[model samples]
Structure formats: structure tokens, C-alpha cells
Target: MSRLRRAAGRIWRVASIPLLAIILAFIVAAVVIVVSSVFTSTGLDVFLPLGAYGSLLAGAFGSGTGISNTLVAAAPLILGGLAVGLGFKAGLFNIGVAGQFLVGAFAAAVVGARLAGAPGVIAAPVALIAGALGGAAFGFIPGFLKARTGAHEVVTTIMLNNAAVLLLTWAVNDLVRAPGFSFPRTGDLGHSALPILLGRNVHLGIPIAVLAVFSVRWLLDRTTNGFEIRTVGQNPNAARYAGMRPIFITTLTMTLSGLLAGVAGAIQMLGVIGFYAPGITASVGFDSIAVALLGRSDPIGILFAAILFGAFRAGAPLMQIETSVPVEIIDIIQALVILFLAADLIVRRVFRVRAAKPVISELATVTRTWAGGAPPGGGA
Candidate 1:
């Protein structure tokens, strides 16, 4: 019974902050909606928030199409969230997910375009692997620099993001311009496209993303490598003292993170867009950082958070069309969710929630890295 209580308490601690944060964000968003309505020439619409939220829920889940769209949109977000979440677990913030995602997409596009005449069995997996490898290679740059020169991943990754965009833009326009297209875009993926599972938009990537969630959870909870990564994240000095190589762990974690984000980009291109284009990313890489933070770096938590964000993305258009609530309101709500989570003390105080106590939770571990201004156990 005590063990059950402890386990439940642990789960509550892991979940409460994000849940409360989301609820508070929605409540605040309702007020913003009301205030904005009052400012309009039309008198205040007191029921606007309720109607907007209802429409959003309906657009996300009310019909078969809505469900499919939600899952399809969620697929890449899940992968991207996992990428950022994994980096967080290792006490690293992989801000370069955008670059890694784009580079991966480019690599996959090139490979996928070349394999257009081939069978799906041959082309799909190859494109996926190409994307992962491309992402891994790009990821290695920052990891190597961080490990060797003590440079921060955030700075290095941001610079790489610019470099990647420049390179890919040039490649698309000059080198791979689809045999005479004026716009910068790649050729159709053809057979390399992920098989559709439901309607037009739903595809195999949804299940693949779901599978990745368990794979990542297993790696962190049931593997030796996960233990090493967490140790290095908590204390590079301790890991070094224990004869573990912190440098190597850091590099590996970042590489895997890049791989996931690369897969995200690849799947988005192959599954949804059917080609690589500049505007296809739709801010997924940036949104993933919020997803990871809200999930507290747990793979399972990241999945749920990704889906929630996905629902917002999938439903926002309908919500705007139906209720005239600006789609930016969704962004505001998401930002508020992040803000509340970042200020957990406010949430705890407002909700009358107590700390889980004595036991060191994953949330505490991640926060220690933030508060200390370095990876735990010693400066990175």
C-alpha cells in the first residue's frame, strides 16, 4: 500500500504542474478573449471563449477527418518533441532542432527523389535512414565542439541553423530544382512517400512516431546507456570520477536527439507534404522545445504534450473560421502554458499542491541543471 502510494505520488508530481499550467493558460486565454471582444466595435461576446474552445475540440476530434488530421499533424511533433526532450534529459538544450530537422529533410529529399522509380519497400526505409544519418552528422558538429572546446550547444546549434537554411535554400534553387521549377522545392517523393493509413493526410508516420515514444522510454528507463547519459547530465565530474566518459555520453545524446528531429523532418516531408519545400516546417521545431519542457523530459509525457499541441494546430483554423478568434490566440495560450510551468511556484501556490518531498524527481533534476547554470555534478 505504501509502495502504491509512493508510485502514485511520483506520478502526480510528474503530471500536476503541466496539467495545472494548461488549465490556467486556458482560463487566462478565455479572459484575453473576453477583453479583446470588448474592444471590438461589436459589443463584448461573453460566450466567445466557450464557443471557440468548443469548436476547437470539435475540429480536433468530432469527426473521422478531424481525428486523422490530429494524428497526422501530431506525428512529427511527437518526434521533434522526443528529440528536444532527450537533450533535456542529458542536461543539454538542443536549440538546433530546426537546423537538424531541415538538413535531415534535405537529405531525405535528395535520396527520396533519386529513388522515385523504386518500390516503396526499397525507397521509404532508405529515405528514413538517410534523414537520420544526415541529422546525426549535423548533430555531431555541435557535440564535438561542445565536448572539445567547451562551447555551448545553444550558440553552436543556432549558428548551424542559419548555415543549414542557407545551404538547403541554395541546394533547392540551384542544384535540385525539380527539373525546371521556378520555386525552390524538390521533386515528388513518389514511392518514398509514407503509405496512407486513413483518408488523405493520415500516414504511416503516425504509428512510427508512436513506436518511437516507447523506444525512447525504454532507452531512458531500461538501458545502461540511459543511465550513463543521465549521470553525465547530473554530474559530468562524477561520471568522470566513476570512469564513465561524459564527453562521449554528451555527444551520443545530442546525436540521438538530432536523429529524432531528422526523422521528424523526413516524415513530415514524405508523409504530409510529399516533397521538400521551404515553408513546410510550420514552426514544429521551435514548438517542440515547449513540448519537451511541458513534458518534463519524459518520453511518455512528451507524446501527450505533442498531441495536445497537435490538436491546437489542427483545430486552430476551424476555431478561427467559426468564432473569429485569431489563430494567434492558440500561440498565446501555448506560451502561457510554458510560462506557468516555468514558474511552478505560482502554480503550486495557486493550486494548493504540495511537493512530493524527499525523493529527487526528474523535474527537480532538470531544474537543478537550470539553477546551477551547468550540467549537474560539475560544469559541462
Candidate 2:
């Protein structure tokens, strides 16, 4: 009983951080709404917090269509969040997921367009594999540089993102532009390539996303490679001393992470858009970083976080129409969640929670120390 109690306590400690942050964000949003309401002719009682929340709920879950849309938006987030979370566990910050996603989607579009007349099973799987390869190839660059030259992955990955944008623009315009369209986008994917789940709009990607979450959970918690990743993340020096190769692990982890992002792009293209364009993903790659952090780098946690964000996204338009509040407020709410998580000390202090020992992200430390010209003892 005592042991079970301790295990329960540990789970709560891990879970409570994000929960408190989310609660605090909503409370602050309510205060903002109420304060802003005072300026209206209807006076201080015009915009009640509960009313805003009710509209949000109604917009997100009131009908089958709303739920389907939410799931559609969430599917990419699950894979993208996993991409970032996987890097976190491996002691690497893969900030180039956005670039990887773009390249991957482009690759998928090219392959899928060519496979227009193929059978569904062959075309769908091939397109997904092509996307994974494209993303993995792009991810390899930063990892190679970080491992070989001691250059920071942050710097390399950010530069690579800019490069990817240019590459995508050029590729779309000169290489894969649809034969008769005015817009610089790829041709629509064949019907065989698209997977339908609920209706025309919602696709089979949701189940695939859920499967990815479980696969990642198993990879990290029950596999030898996962053990290596966690060991290196915890202490590169210790891993090196224990006969592990840091460079190989770092490169491999980034590649795998990029592979996940690539799969996200493929799913988005095949399941949602049915075509490729520069802005099809909107900000999913960037938003996924927040998702990974808010989920505390856990695969299952990422699934739930992605769904919450998806709910906000799905409901934002209705919330705007019903409450006369700007849809941008949802962005503020998301930002606040990240802000509070980044500064967990503030949450603990505000709630009088015990000071839990911090989980040090070794990548952060390595970045700081390496830039100062003295590589740490562990081969990082």
C-alpha cells in the first residue's frame, strides 16, 4: 500500500505541473475578458467567464462535425509533438521539425501525384515512406554537424529551416507545380491515396496518430534504443564511459525524430489537404514544440495536449462569432500555458506546492557549455 501510494504521488507530481499551468492560463484569460467587458455599453456583466467557456465547449463538441474537425486538426499535432518529444528524450533539441515537415510533405505530394492510378494500399504506404525519407535526410544535416564539429544544433537547425523554405518555394514553382493551375502548388493526390475515416473531411489519420503515440511509448519505455537515449540524455559522460557512442546516438535520435515529423506531413497531406502547398501546415511544426513541453515530453501526455489545442482551434471561429471575442485570444491562452510551464517555479510558489527537484534537460546545459569553448567531459 505504501509503495503504491508513493507511485501514485509520483504520477500526480508529474501530471500536476501541466494541469496547474492550464488552470492558471484559463483563470487569467477570464480576468482579461471580464476586465475588457467593463468598456462595453452592457457594462461589467456583459462577458462572463463561464459564458465564454460555454461557447468554447459548445463550439468544440456540440455536434459531430465539430468533433470531427477537432480530431482532424489534432492528428498532425500528435505526430509533430512526438517528433519534438523524442528529441527531448534523446538530449537533443530538434528545432528544425518545421523544415522537415515541409520537405516531407513535398516529397509525399510528388510521389502521391505520380501514383495517381495505383492501388490504395501501395500508393498510401509509398507516399508515407517517401515523406519519412525526405524528413530523415533533412534531419541528418544538423545532427551530423553537431556531432562532428561541435556546432550547436539550435543554430544549424534554425538556418536549415530558412533554407527549407527557399527549397520548398523553388521546388513548388519549378518542379512540381500543377500543370494547369495558377497557384504554385502540387496536383491533388489521387483518391486511392486519401484515407477516409468518418466523412470526406476527417480521415484515417486519427487512428494512425494514436498508434504512433503507443509505438513511441513502447520505444521509449521498453526498448534497448530507448534505454540508450535516456542514458545519454541523463548524462552524456556517463553514457560514453559505459561504452556508448554519443555521436551515433545523437545522429540516430535526430533522424528518428525527423522521421516522425515527416510522417506528420504525409498524414496531413494524404488525410487532410489532399494536396501540398507552402502554408498547408500553418504553424503546426512550431506549435508542436509547445505541445511537447506542455505534455512534459510524454507520448500519451502529448496526445491529450494535442487534443486540447485542437479543441481550441476547432472552436475558435465559433467562439469569435458567438462571443464577439477575437479568435487571437486562443493564441494568448496557448502562449500563457507555455509561459507558466517554462517558469514552473512561479506555479509552485503561487500554489504553495512543494519544491520538486528539477528535471535537468541535458541538451540545454550542453548548448550553454559548448558555446563557451569547453566541451564537457562526456563527449558532448
Candidate 3:
């Protein structure tokens, strides 16, 4: 019983800030709704916020399908959040998940589309590998540059994001365009579709994503390389004194981050789209930054945070149709979550909670990154 209590306390400590942040975000959103109604012809609708939230929650958990939709939407988010979360552990800000996601999905589509009649066992794994390689290759570039040239990852990654979209758009239109389709889309993924789960739209990637969370947790907490990564993130000079190679760890962490994101793209291709198309990412790469911050850069925390974000997405359309509230409200709430996390002191003061900062956080890493020319170990 004592063990159970300790575990519960541990979970609560880790979860308290994010949970409070989410609650505060919704409260603020409610106020926004109440205030906005005053400017409209409807006058002050004090119940507007309650109505909107009702619609959102109902749409997210109202039926079997709603729950399934949440799971399906959450799959890639879990991967994307883990990707960013892992980078935070190593003190690397990987803002190129968008590019990596695109490249991976495209690669998976190319290979999967060619396997016209292959068995699921054979086709699925190969295309997944191609996607992983594609994402890793993109990830490696920035890592290599940052490690060797003292180039900041933020700039290089942002530029690459644009390049990837343009390049993929061209390829989809000209190189791999489906024979019958006039749109900028890739060929059909002939037999590489991931197996559906429980006769629902959910796919193999859902379990894979959950598995990835555990895998990442184990990697960070139960491995020697994990210790080195953490040490480098906390202090590069100290890492050098301990005889660890910061350059290699920097490169490895970024590459691994990309690999996870690439897998996200691959499964999204095989399980969801079955073809690559422009705008397919729908800003998932960007939203994942908020998810990482909400999760405080922990794998387990990322899982819960991703699910919450996914709930918002899965419920947005119905929230719009039912309450006449725009889907953009979801974006505002997400931004608010980030703001609360970045300024956790406000959360602590408001909630009357007392706790020290963790060993690491996405907010800290981001601040250090944007404030400097070169990352610590990578610069030297």
C-alpha cells in the first residue's frame, strides 16, 4: 500500500503542472468565449463556454467511433511528441520534424506503391524501413552540420521544412503521380496498408506508438548512452571532462529523433493515407512542439499529452458544427497551454503548488537555444 501511494504521488507530481495548465487554458478559453459574445448581436451568452465545452467533450467521447477517432489521430502525435521530447533530453531543438515527416511518408509511399501484390508481412516492413531511412537521412544533415560547422539547427531546420514541401510537391505531381489522378498525390500503396485494429479505423501504428513510448523511456532511464546524453544536455563542458563525445551524442540524438518522426510518417502513409499528398501533415509537426512542452520532455508524459492534443483535434469538427465555434479555438487553447508551460511559475503561483524544476525541460532548452549562437558541446 505504501508502494502504491508512493507511485501515485510520483505520478501526481509529474502530472500536476500539465494538468493544471490544461485546466487553466480551458478556463481562459471560456472567458474568451464569454467576452466575445458581448461584441456580437447575440449579446452576452454566459452559457456559451459551457455549451462549447459540452460539444467538444461529447464529440470526443460520445460514442465508440469518437473514441476510435481519438486513437487514430493520436498515433502520429505520439510519435511526433516523442521525437521532440527526446531531443529536449539531449538539449537539441529539432524543429525539422515537419520535413522529416514529409520525407518519410514520401519514401514509404514510393516503396509501398511498387509492391503491387506483396504479402502484408513483406510489404509493410520494407516500406517502414524506407521511411525510417528517409527521415534519418534528413535528420542526419542538420545534426552533422550542427556538430561540425557550429551551424544552428533552428535556421537549418526551418529552411529544410520549406525545401521538403516544395520537393515533395514536385515529386508527387510529376515523378510519382498516380496514373489516373490529376492531383499532386503519389501512387497507391498497393498492399502496404497497415492492418486495421478491432475492425476500426485505428491501425497497427497505434500499438507501435505505445510501444515506442516504453522503448524511449527505457532508453533514457536504463542505458549508459542515456546518461551521456543527459550529461551533455545539462552541461557540455562537464560532459567533455567525463570523457564523453558530445559531437557523436548530438548527432545520434537528432538522428534518433528523426527516426521516430519518420516512423510516424511511414505509419501515417501505410495506415491512414495510402498515398502521399501535399498538406498531409496538417501542422502536426508544429503542434507537437506544444505537446513536447506540455509533456515536460518525458516519454510517459508525452503519451498523455499527445492523447489530450489528439482529443482536441478529433473533437474540433463537431465542436465547430454543433456550437458554431470555429476550430481555431483549439489552436488558441493549445497556444495557451504552451504559454502556461513556458511560464510555469505563473501556474505554480496560481495553483499554490510548490516544486523544484525537473532535471530538464523543453522551455529551458528552447531558451538556451534561441539565446545563443552555438550549442554547448557542438560548438567546441
Best by lDDT: 1
Candidate 2, residues 1-380: lDDT per residue as tens digits?
Answer: 99999888777777787899999899998888888778876578635777877888888888898898889889889999999888877667778899888888889988998887888889888988999899999888887776777677778888988998888988888888998887888887885365786765788778988999999999989998888887777667888888887888888888888888888888888877778866565388898988898887889999999999999988888887887777888888999999898777677778866533334453354345335432222364
Error of 3 at 101 (Å): 0.8
Query: Could you give the candidate ranking by TM-score, starting with the highest?
Result: 1, 3, 2
344, model 3: CA deviation in Å? Answer: 1.5
Q: C-alpha displacement of 365 in model 2, angstroms? A: 6.0
Over 144-246, each residue of candidate 1 has an lDDT whose tens digit, in order, gives 7777666778888989988888888888888887976677789988899888887878888899999999999999889999988877776668788888877
What TM value does model 3 have?
0.94
After TM-score superposition, what is the CA distance of residue 104 in candidate 2 from its true location, in Å? 1.2
Global local distance difference test of model 1: 0.84
Q: What ordering of candidates by lDDT runs from best to worst?
A: 1, 3, 2
Task: Quantify all predictions' global Cα lDDT against the true fold.
Answer: 0.84, 0.81, 0.84
Which residues of candidate 3, in runs, are more than 4 Å off? 1-12, 39-42, 359-363
List the candidates' TM-scores in order. 0.94, 0.92, 0.94
> How would you encode candidate 3's per-residue C-alpha lDDT over 1-380 as one tens digit per residue?
99999778777767788888898899999898888878888789999888899888888788788888888888888998988888878788889988988899999998998884799899998999999899888888888888887688888888988999999988887788877776777777777888897656988999999999999999989998888887787777788888898888889888998898899889888998888887776377887788888888888888988888888988888988987778899989998888787777777787887553563343565678766634844645
Q: Judged by TM-score relative to the true structure, which candidate is superior, 2 or 3?
A: 3
